[model samples]
Target: MDPSFRVLLVCTGNICRSAFAERLGRAWVDETLGEGASRLQLSSAGTRAVVGSGMHPDTALVLAGYGADSGNFRARQLTADHLADADLVLTMTRAHRRDVLSLAPRGLGRTFTLREAGALLDFVDGGSERGEGDHAARARGLVAALAEARSRRPAAGDDDVPDPINQPLETHSEAGQLIVDALLPLLRRLAGAS
Candidate 1:
């Protein structure tokens, strides 16, 4: 059997965007993959974390409104070691992608913004039966497609997840929705959702 895919999410602070992505990504895995969710391990950290902070209070409110929970998350700083560890580094911004690459040059082919991953997944989805056998195989094809996209001229960076720290309730909620819109569908495909 193939090894589990490790997804490490990165943002400016783990308290907001990355933590939120982790939750939403996990929810998609659970909902779409069911017993296969364990095949994809998700975690998050900050490019410049506060180290021990919890999720922004309003983040919980936003997630709760969407029927999910932050579930006792604590922030951690991104490190070179972590960049080396993840099978894929999903960044909240292009800067975070560069940050991961600077720390671990070998990550160049494996890291992408959530939306960037979406774009590449589209390419793979449009033309492929090689990855049709199983949930994990299709997910692997998607990851391979993302790396292929990174190798080309860096694709445009329009899908950045905005930082919502210290923002109004509406802004926080918007951030949540933006992330969900960008992330959920891609995750569903990874978990073999239709």
Candidate 2:
């Protein structure tokens, strides 16, 4: 059996950006990989989460627009265990990435800002639509490939997906769009469909 590849998404409060990305990623996996989606696990948390709180209302609306479920999601605080178990940790911002690393320094190679991962995807060769692997294998390969590619370039100045918790609907939508912009490509690569 292929190993399950775990992905952890992180943000400030886990009510907006990370929450939205988790649902969007799961929906994309289900739609793209069908039963194969079982080989991958996606989860989210926050540096200073509003623990036990539901996703922000604005975030839920953005997800609803994408036809994704926004229910049954309660925010949780980031922990070393979450970092240790993950094969990839995608934070909403560079600061979140640093927070994750501080919790689990060994996760450095596997951690990146969501936008950074998406940008790095363009530099990786193979392991896309023509890749040889199951969903888990593909995801693992994608992480490794991204790690190698990360060192070749300078980190982007605009890698953070801005927080939209207290903002208006439009701001939430923009943040949601930014999350998907970075997330979709990574999901495609994970499913070996890029």
Candidate 3:
């Protein structure tokens, strides 16, 4: 059996975007992969973390609205080891991507902004057979496809998931929706969903 595929999500405070992604992504993994969910490992961190802090209240509320929870999450600082261990590094912004690469230059091939990854989905082959029973394989292939697409194309437009901290609930909802917009397609593809 192959080792589990690891994914690291990076953001500024760890209490908002990244934490929401981690929880929502994990929920998707659990729902889609079922018994095979163990093959995927999801985690998150922050470039400027409030170490040991809980998820931002608004972020938690937004996540809860999506049927995911972050009640047990605690903010942690990003480290090179975290980057080294991940098969994919997804950042909330271009600045966070730069921060990740600065710490682990070798991660360049596997790193991309969350919005960028969503946009790159257009570049992956869509006709391949979906391995419904082996999402791990599908996910691995998807990652490779995204990396290749990353090389073939240059970034376009603003790809940031705006920071919603200290903002209104509507702002938080907008941010969460942006995350869902970028992430749900990937999750569906991973699950072989139409």
Sliding window of 10 residues with minimal summed lDDT for model 2? 126-135
Please list the C-alpha lDDT of all candidates, in the order they appear: 0.78, 0.86, 0.85
Which pairs in model 3 have colliding backbones? none
Worst 10 residues of 1 by lDDT: 126-135
Q: Pick the candidate with the highest lDDT.
A: 2
lDDT of 1 by residue, 85-182 (tens): 78778898888888888898877777888778766665555444244555455556667776775555455748788888878988888888888887
lDDT of 1 at 143: 75
N/CA/C clash count, model 2: 0
lDDT by residue (61-164, candidate 2, tens digit) is 88999999987999999999888888889999888888898889888788999999999988988644355655566667778888889878785779999988
Higher-TM-score candidate of 2 and 3: 2
Best by TM-score: 2
Off by over 4 Å in 2: 128-134
TM-score of each: 0.87, 0.92, 0.89
Q: Give a tens-digit lDDT track for model 3, residues 21-131.
A: 999999988987888777777899999998999999998999999999886999999999999888789999999999999999988878989999889888888743254
